[model samples]
Target chain A: MSDQVVSPRPGAQVQLEMAEQPEVLARIVGRRTELHELVRSRLPSRLRGISLIARGSSDNVAVHARYLLELATGLPVSLIAPSIITRYHHTPDSRDHLVVALSQSGKTPEIVDVARRLADGGGMVVAVTNDDDSPLAAAATVTLAVGTGRELAVPATKTVTGQLALVTLLAEAVGSSIAEYTGGESAWAALPDAAAQTLADERLLAEAVAVLQPRGTAIHLARGLTYCAALEGALKSKETSRRVHEGFSSADFLHGPLTVASDEVAVVAYGARGPVLADVAETARAAAELGSPVIGVGAPEVWNGVPGAIGLAVPQTLGEALAVIPLVIRGQQLAIATTLALGLDPDRPAGLNKVTATH
Target chain B: MSDQVVSPRPGAQVQLEMAEQPEVLARIVGRRTELHELVRSRLPSRLRGISLIARGSSDNVAVHARYLLELATGLPVSLIAPSIITRYHHTPDSRDHLVVALSQSGKTPEIVDVARRLADGGGMVVAVTNDDDSPLAAAATVTLAVGTGRELAVPATKTVTGQLALVTLLAEAVGSSIAEYTGGESAWAALPDAAAQTLADERLLAEAVAVLQPRGTAIHLARGLTYCAALEGALKSKETSRRVHEGFSSADFLHGPLTVASDEVAVVAYGARGPVLADVAETARAAAELGSPVIGVGAPEVWNGVPGAIGLAVPQTLGEALAVIPLVIRGQQLAIATTLALGLDPDRPAGLNKVTATH
Candidate 1:
């Protein structure tokens, strides 16, 4: 008997979520004035510095926030290690500290614990979460509810970009306004369209997915403000595809990890047109010189003619600073494609749950 | 064909340096009062936060310092991304900030540039490098010379531990006195012996090596402050062994990365006697349950009786806070062994220079 042909099921939940990012981000950005008022109202009269508390995809948003807040406030920003509070019981003198706590589910035990403790220690804890009534929101002084609705899939997609947009709004509320760089309020409004169009380019998306080999060494490299996309993309790929892809700043990679670059490895470079876009291109070229397959990220035009780089491109219709949204969606689509290619279900990656109660 | 083969050359420079960590740590700790005074004198009258700037192995040390400084000062501490300054040229208002910059050779251009900018922007910069006369030292308010002397191997051993000791001293100097937990000054004095003894366990070391199958996925897991060891160890192994190993906080690992754990992978857990050691053991046990081989770091007694783990043991004659030194030494030994097993030169790891001029 002749074998009957069958097509594999696309990871429906994750795929839908990835496609829903634009709407989720649009919904969050739609509440811009409200977000600003919420954050600004909770701001301590005299803020010393900012510390971000998050995990998983939210933690990647924290990286984006660290860069955004520091550049905007001219004050130090840190990504808090919750273990300092949870495991070691160190009640750091958080007075004058503005702690931005992020959690999509808002019920992660450690995130709630740290937020509660820091608030108790007199820190201004601003909780960025979807569930305004969740424990983390209760523990914080103020909650900037994500309000993006429910997110499905073990590997988060819409929530990832939604949180990214929320943080960008939070940064502006905390006094970081780069209207010239980020295209102002208009860019925030336009981000959803940009993300949707980026996903619409399935031909190029598949080409980018093709650049990633099944299971070997892979590095996601970017620099400056956009490095967050590299990190978020790497994590998503690992979570959904069961392939290990690390993220590093192109600058950091050149320092020492460049030794690992070879033809066997895939270099997914998040190269966009910005202050450090050339730096990302340089790193991609260097890795390419080492015989590494270079899959360039963000805007087909950005990488289309770049030396030794395949354009796994997205359109940066929004301004440079807002490019992170499209870049992250590119990562989400890449992960889904990679997962399907490896005959795995992105909606249900092995050994993962939607909400990780790490504590 | 005649069955003739030449014996491989053990990477002598790296091997010698690995054996010299105890001495290097002893030398750095010997200058305790001096390190304390240098950091204390440079502390601003009104300190807002601490920012650590470093690269490569030193960046791993910076991670450890981040936890230590935050706990000690009750002030926010950050690991500075040089690109934010170098690429974006944002001169963050660094007033009242204590910036601790670590570079083995003070000549790394980016480190020097950031230090100079932060210093000029009114931050107190404490330069920790071997060369007191180097540009980084010149750009700082004070320099706590890592004066463990020149490190020759591309895979630095003594400098790594030396920087570890110096950061510990810096932490104590800046205010953290974990004397009760770390066994006080005597613990500092005994750290070298602990490291030396840790290196002395060749049989256990070889067994740990055997557990790590040739050229596959490996993960170094730990929690709390000792998580720095897992990160540093992963980096060193990548630099030396060229075998990719990722590091995660045992807490963070359980979050979502546990999906990658399988029998085909090796799990090297930095399990020791401390607040979060049990959490690490739990992660190790979990990974073991997933059929991954678990190689434990630190005192044999700490992991010897732990379920589902093999002791790649080190003695913690000192206290838990001081265990990092020996744990790092264990990493160095493991890296050396891993490198040898891969039939590569650890002394001169492929494509790495003793000084990386990454700008």
Candidate 2:
């Protein structure tokens, strides 16, 4: 349990939560070894694959986990469409499967249903949550609790990044070679401090916000690991500002949706130093050349020489996988600033509750 | 191999292919038994899970297969993100896995790489393609071919629906009791007729177009089985028109992003008589209440009494799973008509090639 959150100003809970991310990351970083041991203990010995289940912001975190698991452990991953179990009543077999269930509150009914059923059917359920005693946590074989205190705002900020941190720890534990590419566990010590530096610099987020039009579809693009940040960025913009901010894989965007890229759409491309960053950069450059305003999210190096784009720089990480922590903070900042620009309260997004009860 | 496609007029290839759905469905329907036997022969002994690999429109069809496989076979499924294989070079163990590799062209480099690598890793590769002689077919343990002639148009209509038809057959074969819910293999005999009847009717799509604005975001909503239709519809619209047409899971919409629903946006809700239909209708109604124009895609029963929405009705299928065939046709028609309304050529989409080489 955590203390009640209070805002310095009226309707500023989301802003406050957004600011708390670094401290939360620091706490999570301190317990990385414990988190690793916990995940290692509960992992299925025969680990055939993974079934990830979550909703809303947590669901985006699951996508990041999918890429991590496959790349690290060579284990295929599925984000369970909870409706397949909850509504369709299909009790899918779970032998040798690991269900990474995530929820900020650990209370989404459908997620709980999925985790419980999969666990009952011979799967290992690992609950990544702020609440360690919620229904979801009870159903899990182990809980990877990364508490970000109490989140009073509807749009998740600290809680979600917390989920990302925990799942990244998960990938680090099971994936033996993941550490080599990403500076390993030793490098995680700098995560919280890097996040703080990112927060101190608002120029990149401001640059992105300055180019974004008040109307029309806003596009977000990324490849590989950073794609999750793009998705969360788009969702936050939509929820808080009521703007149609859309996200797509840099590769997936080229397949067809590239037609929508023009001056009317502001495209934000996220990347870090890794395998697919060049391709992502190329896609962003192509969109910029097509007259769409482009905002590139990465370290200064990602945009220092790139033309036709503004840079949303953060403290660079060793590899693309670990870059998600700071990139997500940048995304959340973009959403907050965008919401404020639209004269809407960032703390209270419309048509949403702290807990969305979707069955 | 198939005949070269000729158009009656310039930029009419996509329109012509859209009109050929019934014939394509008829051919696929006639060979259900053969498809069933082929799938049975290649079914992995003690199948542990399924890995679905695809991109663009073919990828949406893979999502449908995912739902079908999980609902029927009770086996977990994972959609392989090709980057992990092609970019990262991770050789995941695919033993005891059924890899459903879909590419209408079967020439996508990434899809081929994944299918080949997974097969080499011991997965049973099943290629669902229009080109039986393509690299993907060579990489497969079995190939399910559903030819619809050459797709000259940049936007695939018949080829995509053909993939849908074949995957439905694949589902029917493995998802044994899936028939009891969806009226069985015998009921598949009416598939062509049903598709023809759907094509003959155009009022529903017209109704939808009348309400869709020339500018702003268009949202497509669906749940479970019919979610595939909504995704394809959005993709087609984005490709054909330079418009922003987005898709989401009906249940997933309420969590956030609902704030974006307003008069400036158009919402299209897709459903069939299934467990989650009511929830989808509620979401559409909520969006309509927010002043966003609403289009309901399904049979007469789906929209007969529903207020605050225009209906895009199709010939009724027996159950939600079977309904995707007709719903997809309706979605394609919507995209074509939407493009025509925008003074854009449907046959030749801007910023798109027939096969997008993402890798």
Candidate 3:
């Protein structure tokens, strides 16, 4: 039951080589040309709205893309779950829409079905995936290969980051100037370095794990674009840690959720622009004063003065990169810790299947 | 810990009584008078888009309102959480939109502050609340009073139904003729009776409680407008039963969540128009066959053939009423049962508070 101890098996070196190497991930990244070509070749005659499909980590990518596209071009957008589209499989009469399907493996049956349904309905399908030859790619009218190299862990990391990059590029193609203004290209390029820096202090993260491991609930707060990142983080935490975690806007947290503060509670705040960051810090301070441990993730400007807080200096772009990795790592570690603590196997969460087919 | 002896808190009573029946809720039936008022009162002179601010049960109401308005007016609408609005308390310079805030008590401090902020920012504010004298009501430029009678329970029931009634009226006001076709008036009038009917068989619900009380995770599924009801139900169940319950569209559940189904899981399906109902029931049946207990809270047609399923018929209008009372009762009973089982007090959840305020 002791929370401290590192296991010897498939350590960070393997993850770094397989999941983080720029050259490895660059395979997916370099597919931007093919992706652009696929999208252009299958461009709709008229555009009314864009629909994005994904589930789990890929779903996070889809949501980010939706916001990025709207912010960039003020284009109308909708998110269609693969299950929904597949159930109603038919050619949509509307020719003025585009459907984008994202999956890392590109073999998920439902996603493949969704891509096919959209295409059959005469709607253009764009598949963003790591595997170019997977069913999703085959069904898609256009396939944007994410080339995230290989993901070995059951939980996704590099692929998720790659999906974010592809989404940013897609948003750029669709006329989102914010991507340009936000220095997304540089941010994307700096990911490997940023990720390396984040993992540099595994001991620091391990200490954080010690603080958080006992808690049953974690609250993640972020605003605007970063909110999506927080959501992805929370989801990973939930799936990996088996802990109840909710991702909400920092400002929103202050309104009501902060009342739950206790010494045992863990609050992770993603400091974003606007007064929300300050507000969340204040709430964290209040929680700390109440004996709760608050972990501040983001810039010092946002984390200053928070008591018993782990202030991780995550820049906006670096923040996005740093955010998902910790969550994945924490989730994996916690899953191991929890399983060992409960005398179970980390390899298998009870009653869970690797692939889900609704039919 | 014994399940057989559990009984409901005796005697049904009319909890809420509207003072002066607003014609909009009482007579107009399905008309969207409130929506029209919201649009006419708040929209920019040119009218382009809309954003909504609401929390708790009202948040669920806002989701439905957003969906209906989008379908009817084709206006881009987004739901802004009250926390987000309160976090960014500054007024926007643009007047091209409106922010509608809904609350039953209208005294929720955060909601009141958000309403004031929206009004101060020169954005049109519309308050849909039962208490006309509440702070939220006083802060709005135009307030639509839903004369839903007093609610005594901590969890909202009639107020939510009344709120939907008002939101539907608002949709009519905006010139959406869908209300007329909804058969809302007959449904509304039949609600009390339907609620009574559902409560008549306390044994059935109590048996359901036996199955649901022990579970740690639950998913509530529904489609279209009824999905909002499911969301509220899930929230109530979580808050009352002190369990982790997520509400999602029946269609959305099949995406990836289906992979985690087990015999011990509980799936509550709220059926409505379209294939979503059947799809969800099928999913539930598959889960049930796998050993999970499936609860259907809709028409029998949707629940047919699902083993160990409990069908609580709620006519569309009456559905909200029928579904909510039992939900509240079930939640309260579960809370009591779980509290006793876990040696905790039903009055307090660990690390949670009644009212949350920023430091």
What is the TM-score ranking, best to worst?
2, 1, 3
Worst 10 residues of 2 chain A by lDDT: A1-10
- The residue ranges of model 1 lying beyond 4 angstroms of the native Cα positions read A1-10, A300-308, B1-10, B300-308
DockQ of each: 0.64, 0.80, 0.18
B55-88 in candidate 1: lDDT tens per residue?
9888988888888787777776889989888887
What interface RMSD does candidate 3 have? 5.6
Q: Candidates 2 and 3: which is better by lDDT?
A: 2
Q: What is the lDDT of residue A222 in candidate 2?
A: 84
True-vs-predicted CA distance for residue A66, candidate 1, Å: 0.9
lDDT of 3 by residue, A174-264 (tens): 6525543334556556655555554453444555666667766666666645566666666656554445465665644443345445665
Model 1, CA-based lDDT:
0.79
Q: Which pairs clash in the backbone of model 2? A: none
CA RMSD per model (angstroms): 4.7, 2.5, 7.3
lDDT score at residue B184, model 3, on the 0-100 scale? 51
In angstroms, how far off is A291's CA in candidate 1? 1.3
List of chain B TM-scores, one per candidate: 0.94, 0.95, 0.77
Of candidates 3 and 2, the better by TM-score: 2
